[model samples]
Target: MTKFIVKDIVDKFGYDVLAGKDGINRAVKIYGINRPGLELAGFDFEKNNINRRVILLSNKEQLFVNTLSEKVKKERYEYILNENIPMIILTEKFTDKILLEIAEKHSCPVVRASNITTSRLYQLVLEFFDEHFAPATEEHASLINVFGKGILLRGKSGIGKSEMTLELIKKNHLFVGDDRIIIKQRNNRLYGQSHEMLKNLIEVRGLGILDLSKIYGLQVLLDETKIDLVIELIHLDDEQYKSIDRLGIEYKYIKILDTKVPIITVPVTYGRNVSELVETAVSKLKLDEAGISCLKILQERFEEYSK
Candidate 1:
């Protein structure tokens, strides 16, 4: 339900507004961009529900339209204008005076970007829409990338989340964010990043704040990553530990911005190497992704032995 104005795109991309300045406030309801190729070739816009999409006129599409007869071109323009599209973008220095006139007549905004190619323009607009329309939330935790997998560490303050992340950093894992992690859901996946002011800064008890990138080198940090796992560290008494499941066969998931990320609960007990345990957990997740589940295999063997 997110809406953006044609003026927003014009301001953000610095596009030249060729005509339809009065329609700058036109609402763009959908994040999709259309080429208008099929529509130019007699496709029905109403049937396809393309009236809400922002139209882009690339070089090839423009050239193809130029080959059509004048009557067909006029009809195409009339059909498009009547549909009341959000806006039209001409990519890579290609411009049609006739199309601009039609847009002006119907008060449809037409913009031109001459610097980038059509594909690059498409990519930029896609990224803009993805970031603008994505569902996002924030978490008070630390995120790190280990072996190309993003792992989020969450727990109460003083539960050693930062300290454990420090250990992972020493083991050559990459740090993403500390204290506050911004998580956004795009295409059913969760991605995490640090706040602008807190990036690369980690706080340790009694040690003050430390710049992790400075100490461990720039290669030991990632600006953002797709969150693949969530680990929660809990300080449990002996009785509490005894009441928990020992088999570790249950699946736990934490919801972040409409995406469910697998979560593991680890007891923060003395003499336990939480960092190593997390590392091993990530490796096990990789194995699970590859369809090699150690827990399932052990359960199968146990079933056979019991029989």
Candidate 2:
């Protein structure tokens, strides 16, 4: 389970602290945001799951609270604050004295964002929560995005993974990460990124460490990408290579988190253009995805001829 603190939100979003400064250490468990508009309209607000969420009061909600009678306003505000929500956010400079007072009394953090509108604030907050709460793991591999398709290269150390990645970058493909790849799972899709310290950097045997962004320009570096294909490089003898499947009809998959990504095995041999071969493999994968599998088409024709 992932946990985000009120202070994390404040630091990330640059929200102003209006009240409950001491409660900034509170934990936010839910990834959803609540508007509290229905609650201010005399509706019986659901408090069961309110404590886990960040409640927001936009301009329209603040206006609705202002129009209510003093007794009703106090009652509603008291009911909401007593629920001990993780935090409350006010958008577009909205500030209500009573709401702030009640939040302070209950020790619930209240924050204000002056620049963004209500809808935009909601969108931003939800996006942040989605990323912060997603499941993540790390891998020892090189990740690159070729023609908008993410390709992961895995092999033993000193097996030319980084060298091949550099070649692909020279061919104008985007470099995601080298040596270490941080993968996060969201909505059953795995997204890969490099560690902050290693971003835009790759280590080659003779060249040592090279900053790709500086050498190949900014277009050569990619911040992150989905893991679409996993290619494992193997150093096999000529006979061993000949023994492997040649039809390319066998389906192989590698599981990352809960998603299964197609895997291709490439032999690393002397005089072999591994970089171009990997590029061709990616093209074939894309064509297969588009229902144009060459192997499948040939198999269909062979079956028809046999009949």
Candidate 3:
């Protein structure tokens, strides 16, 4: 992955360059917004990961800097800048003259984010870095939203994933992607979307390619969704289906970009309403969440009758 740098943040946020033009390209390793409360009180910079974060001297830090001895301020400033951190951001209401002098001397970029409070700026900058460093991948699947649950349909070619998607949309579910899905994992959760070219479009055997937005209206389309469950379709005969676990008491999770997503295998047979099965499966999941499982209830009833 390309390193996110100080200049990138400067250009992106339109912040003023108060000092340190030379080191504006310094790389950022983490998304932490460091206020340096500990370092201000004479804590050692060498002992912590200051270089990994973009130092922000907010209004509080700036006011606190005035009370510090000139020796303490100068020594701490030099120590922090020497780490070669990405940048130092000053919020709207704050600036430290001594810190800027040391920062300029060491070539550590000092940016001024105007018109935003320290708390708001911290939240904004954290989100920016978190999103920038998010892990992403591509998967071959048809993603849809059924009963407000994001469902990913996967199988071999000609296994009716697209056909099932069509039927699901007709039943008022939302379509996300067909064939190629761009899966991004952020903050330990996976979000899936279609490529711009493939958005709201699906190819059927007899219908070639169809724009779902045109046929079913734009209300039936979604650009992306959080992947809640994956339903894998398999062409299983009755004998093969009977051998597998009939009760879904335990769910198996498949790792997608460092996130484990629950996966369930469904047998697809000729003349079966695969889309209805998919919807019913999601409904069962909802019931399971509500502490009502038909299979578990059946087991209890059978045990009671035997007793």
* Model 1 Cα lDDT, one tens digit per residue, 176-223: 999999888888999999987899999999999999878888998899
Q: For residue 79, give model 3's deviation from the true position in Å.
A: 4.6
For candidate 2, the lDDT comes to 0.85
Candidate of highest lDDT: 1
Clashes of each: 0, 0, 0
lDDT values for all models: 0.86, 0.85, 0.84
- Tens digits of lDDT, candidate 2, 22-127: 7999988777887777677756446665455788887778778778887898888887775458899988656678888878888889999987877888888887
Q: For model 2, state the Cα shift of residue 49 in Å.
A: 9.2
Question: Better model by TM-score, 1 or 2?
Answer: 2
Backbone clash total, candidate 3: 0
User: How does candidate 1 score on lDDT?
Assistant: 0.86
Where model 3 places Cα greater than 4 Å from the true spot, the runs are 1-29, 37-51, 68-79, 82-84, 97-120, 195-201, 209-217, 237-243, 300-307
TM-score of 3: 0.76
Question: What are the runs in model 1 whose C-alpha is more than 4 Å off?
Answer: 1-30, 35-52, 58-87, 91-95, 101-124, 238-243, 296-307
Task: Candidate 3: give its CA RMSD in angstroms.
Answer: 4.0
Ranking by lDDT: 1, 2, 3
